[model samples]
Target: MAKALGIGGVFFRARDTAALAAWYEQHLGVPGFWLQEAGLTIFAPFPADTDYFPANRQWMINFRVDDLATLITQLQAADIPVETRPDEWDTPETGRFARITDPEGNPIELWEPPAA
Candidate 1:
């Protein structure tokens, strides 16, 4: 049987699509049609009552980065609030993680997988 290859795109509603798109491009370096580097992509389905993300939102997007510390600093310098849980979220096996929200209140996860 043939299996799905990978995620083609992510679609969601935004109050101002143009502004939101630009914000992503400027802050996170994600464009409308991004050519992402090949890496691990997780496909998880959470329970309805899961509190991993905001209760008001149905979905969250995760993006893998090479340098989490630099990215966090850049985001903070741009006046964007970034949440990190080093003690609770980071590990030698999994790597570091950070969380941030878009202007429209969409949760975004930044992950840096452990080095090979």
Candidate 2:
């Protein structure tokens, strides 16, 4: 039997590809063709018209982060945008979360899982 262990890459269309790539690198510290931490890979395909995220956008990209507070502050200082609704999403078991949009209007969810 064949089985897949993890996501290899995430390739998507962008309006200004180079600027978008730079946005991820400058604000999110994620270079394109990334090999993320701890072999942590996510594979989930959102529906074409999914409202699980904001309705204005067609797709969302979720990334896992280590320290939410520090990252949020750094992004703010750098003039990178961040949107947080902790009361709407946070729970005792799920830890903290925030949201942001890339330069191309693709949403990126920042998730920090609860510590053991």
Candidate 3:
């Protein structure tokens, strides 16, 4: 039985594709195709009426990071505002999370799974 192993890629359109790609590379170190570390990959769909993320946007991208705090600092240094909800978002089972937006206003979630 042939089946999909994992998410091969995530493709999206941008107004200025080149500039957006460069922003991703410079800020997130994601050079188009990244060699992500082997770990859990969440594939959950939110409820239609849920307000977890912005309602205006159709989707949000979550990236698992080794160090969320460090990334948040770096992002802030680059003048990107990071939205954090430590009280409500962090947990012993899951992890800490922080949110940021791209130059084009695309929401990005940075997650750091609880230490194993």
| TM-score, one value per model | 0.98, 0.84, 0.96
Residue-level lDDT tens digits of model 2 in 1-116 = 99976776778888888988888898888897776787345567778777778787766777888999999999889877888888898776887888877767788999887786
Q: Per-residue alpha-carbon lDDT of model 3 for 53-87, expressed as tens digits? A: 89988889999899999999999999999999999
Candidate 1 collision pairs: none
Question: Relative to the unseen true structure, what is the C-alpha lDDT of residue 84 in candidate 2, on a scale of 0 to 100?
Answer: 88
Compose the digit string of candidate 1's lDDT tens values, residues 1-116: 99999999999999999999999999999999989999999999999999999999999999999999999999999999999999999999999999999999999999999999
lDDT of 3 at 73: 94
Q: Give each prediction's root-mean-square deviation over alpha carbons.
A: 0.6, 2.1, 0.8
The TM-score that candidate 3 achieves is: 0.96
Q: Name the lDDT of candidate 1.
A: 0.97
Quickly count the clashes in candidate 1.
Answer: 0
lDDT, residue 75, candidate 2? 82
Task: Evaluate all candidate structures by whole-model CA lDDT and list the values in order.
Answer: 0.97, 0.81, 0.92
Winning model by TM-score:
1
* lDDT comparing candidate 2 with the true structure: 0.81
